[model samples]
Target: MDKEQQIAPSAGQKGEEQHAIDVGTGEHGDGGGGIAGDAAEASENERLALVEEPGKKKSTRVAALDAFRGLTIVLMILVDDAGGAYERMDHSPWNGCTLADFVMPFFLFIVGIAIAFALKRVPKLGATMKKITIRTLKMLFWGLLLQGGYSHAPDDLSYGVDMKKIRWCGILQRIALVYFVVALIEAFTTKVRPTTVRSGPYAIFHAYRWQWLGGFIAFVIYMVTTFSLYVPDWSYVYHIDGDVNDGKQFTIQCGVRGHLDPACNAVGHVDRMVWGINHLYMQPVWIRSKDCTFSSPRTGPLRTDAPSWCLGPFEPEGLLSSISSILSGTIGIHYGHVLIHFKTHKERLKHWLLMGFSLLVLGILLHFTNAIPINKQLYSFSYVCFTAGAAGVVLSAFYILIDVWGFRTPFLFLEWIGMNAMLVFVLAAQAIFPAFVNGWYYDSPGNTLVSWIQKHVFINVWHSQRLGTLLYVIFGEIVFWGVVSGILHKLGIYWKL
Candidate 1:
């Protein structure tokens, strides 16, 4: 990674549960999703902050990677903050893919590309592992602070969460976990010196055999556990009224194996046991299912006779699903490795096209055949293939436009946002800045600067509510953050991790 260009990973947007027929955002996650943060995204920022020496700039960082990362952050902000106004920005309901469904996969894929570069030539195992561990911790800290039930942004003034109820899994947490595990595999197996493997089309595969094995292990674990494990009938305490004063207990029946229904999946079972039901993400996307709610794909009143698990919380980024997600990062590493070894541009593009198309076809086959449906919430194997493959194709476009064609002027906005991803996501994407401004009001708590601007300044001015809200999000929020990030980048103020 180039130290000077090194900045925070791009990311944001976590939709819990909001269902209004008029409000158009699709069903999404309980916790936020991450951009593909480089292992170096955090570490390299520290370097650029302190030193900008030419001698330290040993390798040229890929600008396209940064651009792609920025795109993820931008998309997250658009989907998360503006999604309510536009259904197109929303994630899928359950089984199908949508615009929002692509965000997390893109994030993870970029993180993988970064890991390859950051650990291209690890000199010392202890030192590299320590850096990876520390970065992981930092990423988790930010994720927890933003999504671990403490932040009731744009709504509640309270900022404390019960320790027992704090969410244990989320976007950055998953990124941190994937980064740590993938970096470890690369550090352990990657040769101290680069080996020129010019054997054939399978050269890179052979060279990174051990790392591939590591990915294979992760894949095997996710698959075997998902299929073979028995999910027992379990009970979780719930609040019938959503009031702290009163609560209820619900038992979800799932005394079977290989069941992938929204209720009885082994994926949810593993999460229940590992993170504990209360600690997992409480606002699962599945709450919008037809069987659970009066409104499908949107949060509304519960059905007259909702299933036992209708309101049950599940973690999309849980331990087991993450094992499936790891393959995404590893696939990205392959792309990065191609960049490292193959000198010719044609070779890199060729490899990427082959890999990307292959996975896409496989994923489609799996979904159509019902072998594994493409469910983003489940992080299913087929979903992994489709998203990762899509990521490769998207990255290829970025590489061509930004790096190959010298079209930097056009994507300058995204470039700026990508380079200062951390600051933008924290303040704008996560709604932290808006929430902070929401504290004061002339009459009531909701009548603050944030609401005033969105309502009176933007929403009211426009004839249509949906159009007004959409425009406000695009300009008031996204474009505003873009300018802020651009200014900070110009001033050499980069916030990472």
Candidate 2:
């Protein structure tokens, strides 16, 4: 695997080829109409109308898409670097909903949508399967690495690092896993046509079919696992719960570890083992499994919180649920891709409004199904469906107004950030800053700038700590993007993942 794989590919040949098919018309929009030929012509016309300079238009790229991506990234940075300010932030109690809760799922959903565009490109260019494979693996490895890797802590912060107790999985790991699975399906579905001027053995491949099939299979599997598999196991438990603890804590957090795995419950039993006993660390929800809430390291005789048992790979967006996430992304990609091919303004607007409302309905419906649960933490299936639908609506609006209607002036800043999302996110959130730099650049000078404004510039700047922190982070994000816009203007690295 290599670094290249760590990043998802850009919307490649598919966008280009689709455009090529609809070329000629200076104003064709991909508003999901009937003919590819006519749509291409209209798209050409629309493309020409957007910019006076031929080179600058392509260089500037899709303003709407960039704006959406940028907005998502900004929110991500705000949520992640919340900076010890919880009060001002909106958070649901345990199994509840809050405004901030939507950010993660939205991010993952976007990643899936991006994959759709990338996969579309893989086939047309005849990109090698080997390259894709290598890239996917590399990303997976880095994702895991981001989770904590061999070290307990993820780089350094004010909080001390603990190597022995590092979490085994996290956001990057999830991204890697999802990307690998999606890429694999895409590769299997697409095939290389035998080229007379090239290779001898290759014929043709449906590299994309597998992704479609796999997506269906994954959904079915999630249903089976959540409904049939876990339900039965839970049902088998004696009615003792009916008379025992009345606490909502009836919801167990460990599976297979309490009674099923004696060693996990008795931590002392494995003291001599080399990697320590991972039984307590293997939570069912964290990985692909037919169980849930099965590990409790504290009850395992350790009688200590230090080497606390793993939280059971318990993810809001575990393997079983990611199916919905992928679906959401696929919808966005397809909708965006198809819309860009429309020729007539009226037709484009009609499709955009219709699809937008349809998706909004689907999202609202999915939100009610507590079965899949609307949880951003697990990237729950229902969450994906709902969020994706909403994202589509948003994308459609952007497509119609900015791309089709040429009303793109208001979102230029967001588009700038969107063009370089990954870099912006990593640089803003994960990149470490020394204490001195934080004091000099952020606290001291930042306060001066803030004071120059109308609002209070100190700790009391906002009514709540969390609000102040959020505002501060947002300010940081804007500054980062400003620097990024300048660099991009100079170096032309607009979309380097």
On TM-score, the leading prediction is: 1
Candidate 1 clashes between residue pairs 3 or more apart in a chain or in different chains: 19-299, 36-107, 36-111
lDDT of 2 by residue, 1-497 (tens): 22112111233223433332222110122211111223444355334433223344332134465566666766666655562355223333223344556565555555554544344434333343554455556545655544443422222223533555544445555555565566555445545411111212111112233445656676666554444432111111112245332222222323332221211221112221323322112332121111222232111221223112222223343444454455554444444334333333454356545665765565556666534345554444555555665665676677666765568777766666665665565555454332224433334444433333314542466666556656666665565565676467456454332
Regions of model 2 farther than 4 Å from truth: 1-60, 83-91, 94-97, 119-127, 149-164, 191-211, 231-313, 340-356, 369-372, 431-457, 460-464, 494-497
lDDT by residue for model 1 (367-462), tens: 999999999888999999999999999888887787666687777778777777767778887888888888887788877887778788887898
Question: Of the candidates shown, which would achieve the greatest lDDT relative to the real structure?
Answer: 1
Root-mean-square deviation (CA) per prediction: 9.2, 12.6
Q: Mark the 10 consecutive residues where model 1 has the least summed lDDT.
A: 12-21
TM-score of 2: 0.61
TM-score of each: 0.86, 0.61
lDDT of 2: 0.43
